[model samples]
Target: MSAALLAALTATTPAAAAPPHWTIAPSAGGGSRPAAQDGRPYIYAEGAPGSVLEDKVAVTNPSAEPLTVAVRGAGAPDVRTKAKGPGAWLTFATRSVKIPARTRAEIPFTVTVPAGATPGDHPGAIVASGGGRTSGISVHLRVSGPTLSALTVEHVRVEGGDRIAYEVVNRGNTTLTPRLAVRADGLFGGVLDKGPRTLPVELPPGRRVRLTEPWHGAPALDAVDVKVTVTAGGGAGDSATATARFVPWGPLGGALAVLAGGAFAAYASVRRRRRKGPGPGTGNPRSAP
Candidate 1:
């Protein structure tokens, strides 16, 4: 062969093989898990607003020899690793992970939910590159808002006169303006007290408040029922019901006399019934009377 032709052929020819080697399995991580072979892998997380999620990556060495895997890019400033020494989110930590022949290792990356974080879905990935070879995996994450709120009314009681008091609370993230409705029945007859009274209050994130309403006119007798409703922006609203005992007022002496008379009447009625007992029973008397 000519010298020039031989040089060109050598340059174009492929290099000789060294030894038998193991081949990496395609889709070894089942397409769901992220795997790092020659280079870095990427993953994703999804969370709600003010929520957190985590993504993981695995490195596998298919060869017969032990493989030393060094993890990096987690602490990088531009990287979004939610790790902190204390009270931090989206954190990641890993030492030199050694995967023995036909073995694998794991590395985790966490994504923290941010306070006042906007509501939406976010996408991120972890790049795992090493050993002169590279591979990438993707991460998916989502964030959402407050689902619902629980409201309760407790200890509703009527004071000395016709005054009523109860408690109102907002167990939600958003502020609330509760509309209260009072209804009383039983001895006082059916009556409805409806008002669009604004509470003139702002409840911020996990707070409670006490409310009192007074009823004029005749004192309530027997049981009194109160129904309360709460409404707020974003079409968030709730309702609750509470009951109180209403006491009637009268002259002290007169009230005492009435109670005594009622008790005496009840006792007399019981005695009369006992005396008239077994009237129609045909039984053997002690001595035929």
Candidate 2:
């Protein structure tokens, strides 16, 4: 064979390749539930230890060959995990589980937050690995314990008339029933009125409710200081205070009217003096007689 022919044949032939192309992607399925993806998944439950929280994890097969994935638990000592059928059941230590590729399966996992685990938030992550590819995802767990009801007055503003509208928000994850108390103070820092009013509201986590306090005898006040205190379910221990400005339109208008009248009177008096003939015959000294 000629050297050119041999070189051409060798170049035309295909070379040995590496392993099959494999990739991992997160997904969610089952019922109307929303799945976590892009490195974050949200799991919600209200129970004691050994309680299972079921969630779906998705695995995709982009390669020509089928791949088997392993879903595993990772993170802090208070969490655990195990595979539940196509998915995984995470116990106290189970944070994550895996699913197979090319078939796209949903894995169910249970999170058993140990007893006495801080009533606030416990953070952990679940990892899925297969076909020489691996990715880790985080799980947000909120533990519930004794109800610590708290209330916060997020915003306060005075509208038309003697009405004061306030926005109260419950920053805690639990529901809260709030009772609000509002006090109006003059610019000199003197309390104008104080009363006990019940503002019933069942606000969920990160929710806000508006309350209006109409002062039946609020004297016309312009730019007065206001202080608001909120108590959850009449609990004094969990209260919040906020201060704002209260401007009354009626008083402001009256002040503006008085200023305008003064300006008008001054202008009219100057015009009348100019029109009168320089004090009863005191004519312009520069004019010809």
Candidate 3:
């Protein structure tokens, strides 16, 4: 074989494509630096209504090629469109930026809290998109004002014969971690007593979540009254009740049939005694009169 043909057959295969060499993070200590400080994963801000707060996000390009990134707000309260929440209150100094190879760009942004905004945590995120990939840093903005922790339990009911389902709503201005208690009273006595336990849910203001609790020990034959009580810190609490009936018609029907037969037999015995009247040991009531 020729040397040229042998060399062509030994060529290496093409390699897979590489991922983008860029990152986005919260600016270090609100400084002009492009890297984040340790233990500072998200941007935090606090202000009262009608106040303006500022923050920065850093986008770094470590590759040898220059990168252009498009920045915007995401998640709840985004300001990019007509929406409510902290995202809507944010405004960026520039929506697009170009960083040279091995450089970082720090973009500034402002959050303007409306005068009528409620007091509580309004979470949002700043996102940067480049090279078909995206990165984001969270923004935790808490408004200063009177905070209330209140909730409501609604639509309580039994589901699938083995679970209790209900809806919990946060009616206060602050977020709530609710604790739930379930109880059931039957015709005889208390049949279900589930003590209070912390629910794996985070209820934000004006949000309602539907959740279910396992009721594997539900009564097999009873008309039960179920109640769900939800409480959270900051004086938030509510209760709701529903009724469920679980009857085994197979057994109940047989019992009813036996009782009917016994009543008929007792009636026949009483009639026979009335017709026979007095015996030899006793006088007749009609003859004495």
Candidate 4:
């Protein structure tokens, strides 16, 4: 085979031929009665403001070789790049651990809720990275207080005459599953009306997502006012509107060409009249004398 063919095959091959076989999950209850509690799929905790909660995560290595893993919290706090949610509240005793083959290590962690933390579900995850692979176990932390769900629709507009774009913001302290409805009014009457439908997105508290809706049936020539309404559970809803104008340029261009041709002909007639130099019966004093 050619050298180029050999190089191509080498490039397509993966660096790691063996698949990683390790797992991370929430630890079962600790102490003498460790088997007294049932197995947990994820970590769950609830506390009042200014409280400290404890939990444990387990990492298991089934491979023949020892495995070293790095652990950290992700999600909520990383959403807006600020330390305000449960992701930032996590504090592990040790962030790294090593386990011998066929062994499991349980690590303890603490979640310290701030004094002014809001009340709602602050979903996060404890992630383990090892052996060129990673695993994450979810953490559902809720603060004890009244909860609220509110959202807003903003920046609604049409794009490329075929898509409607907008932004949805979760303004409350609770996660929201939003539904969207679209309506457009034109010069003559309503041009487009799409009923409410669930958006394939879950808006976490204090986060915004930009989404687009298909507008394949948009009019070719009309001035339209598009209104977008978004609503979520718990009486959270808001609406925004934008205006767009569409013109059938193909037909307009033909009419403009005809007008241009007529203007050019009128100009030619004026030029020819000027060149004829005052035809028949036109008065000239020197010629009359």
Candidate 5:
């Protein structure tokens, strides 16, 4: 029922060569921010679903002329889009403010997470609009909930030196620490059986990471099928398979040459024996005697 106050990390709107000393930062204290908060250039908050977190965004104008800034809240912007993601959840105290030259104005705001929000990170921002230019600080909100680990291994291929390459995708709504195991089978049986090896990764939801596994000593000549299996602590599991063929061309070629030479020698011996048989009445010695 009660809204708890959060001390914000601080950031200042970059001073342009033009005007409006507009600097935006989170309120650190009564009038001054603590040194710890000074290192934080952005606003970071943690809360559960349906919880309201309150903070302030300070706007300072040190320009010689009075500045009237229009405040607006926008969702966090992404590389593919600006003003995207859960920005509507933010509410500001005042929509607009007129600040005298060389003065700073602090605008209070509250961010309320929806009850149905997924347990993960949601980005947003508080913007001050003036002279067609808008600047603000980033807010990162982490919603706490049940942690689920889901992972998938894909696009598996064997590179040089028995190195296995594959991609891991996180399909669930939680961050996962994943480990990988590699197994390869040849015409006879298992050629490469690599035990489960822990990978250095913290995969977040909806992200795919490419990783590789080293199979130190692979069979020289074999038609092998390789599989990569990924698993995490919270029951996350997935596997992908691929095939590769390895041959020792030098050894194979030498074996073929030796067989050909032996066949030629046997054929010559048979022809010589047939030509000499009963050629010159050699077996009719009785008539000549």
Candidate 6:
């Protein structure tokens, strides 16, 4: 056998491979429930727009082997894309850490809220990544703003009996549990008068949701104007209106037809009486003679 051929037979080919992402799932520090009762693998912090808050996060490694991970703060991924909020404001002590097998590490961090920060929830994440694999703990940050409720109802319309469709907008910086009071008025008087009832919704700031309200049996024949008034926590409230016309066209047409027939009969009776009178005189002049 040739030397070159023997070398080729023993040669081994390499396969493509990449590193994996890893991180520890965040939990409450005390192992008890969070203050806000939000059960998420996240760091929750609240502060004013021009303030700074401090907190510590524990990163655990349940793996059997030793590993070195890069710990950093990254922008929280929004429903649409990455958020450019609190993530940009977080500052960490160390950028990387080496952990032994089956151990945990505690890292302290501070969040500095900008004076001009928007008053609302700003999300971010603390990521631990190595060998291409990445894991993250969510950061829920709320910047303090005026404690006010602001809500508005829009695009209100009556679909049918008791079925009112409307859109509610949250124009405040907090989550709201809204209530609705639907009232309807007709040409004669009020038809529906429903007081405020708690809505089955949780509206986040700057969000809009469409909902329907029920009415058992609405007016059968009348022109109605519907008004939907909504209110919520923080004194947030607004009103909107819609119009509906419900008439029994079948009965109306029949009644008009009967009146027209009666007028025709009266006209025939008058014509018969005129024909019996004298032609030129047009009246009964000495009829007996």
Q: In lDDT terms, how accurate is model 6? A: 0.72
Which candidate wins on TM-score? 4
Off by over 4 Å in 5: 1-52, 55-83, 86-140, 144-147, 187-191, 253-289
| Model 2, residue 1: C-alpha shift (Å) | 86
Local error of candidate 2 at residue 10 (angstroms): 78
Q: Tens digits of per-residue lDDT for model 3 on 175-218?
A: 68899999999999999998999988776677778999999878
Task: Give the better candidate number (2 or 5) by lDDT.
Answer: 5
Evaluated at residue 23, the lDDT of candidate 5 is 66
The lDDT for every candidate, in the order shown, is 0.50, 0.52, 0.79, 0.81, 0.72, 0.72
Q: Candidate 3, which segments miss by more than 4 Å at Cα? A: 1-18, 31-37, 62-65, 75-83, 249-289
Per-residue lDDT of model 2, residues 1-289, tens digit only: 1122223322322336543344333344521245455442433444544454545555566565666666665544422122221112254223333333345555655665554454533444556655554554544555666544555775676666467778876555444556666777666666556565666554544456677877666555445666777776435324334344555667788999999999999999999988874685576567578
| Model 6 lDDT per residue over 98-215, tens place | 7777888877778888887777665566766654455566666777876556878999988855589999988776668899898999999999999999987766566688998887
**Residue 40 lDDT, candidate 4, scale 0-100:** 75
TM-score of every prediction relative to native: 0.37, 0.40, 0.71, 0.82, 0.51, 0.55
Count of clashes in candidate 6? 7
Can you write out model 1's per-residue Cα lDDT over 97-141, one digit (the tens) per residue? 666788766666566767654333333333343444433333333
109 Cα displacement, candidate 5 (Å): 6.2
Error of 1 at 151 (Å): 3.9
Q: Please give the RMSD to the true structure for each candidate, in Å.
A: 23.3, 17.1, 13.0, 7.9, 9.0, 14.1
Least accurate stretch of 10 residues (summed lDDT) in model 6?
Answer: 1-10
Worst 10 residues of 3 by lDDT: 1-10
Residues 98-195, candidate 5, lDDT per residue (tens digit)?
88888888888787777767776655666667844566666666778876667788899999846889999887765577888888999999988878
Clashing pairs in 5: 13-23, 13-24, 75-87
Q: lDDT score of model 4?
A: 0.81
Give the clash total for candidate 3. Answer: 6
Candidate 1 structure lDDT: 0.50
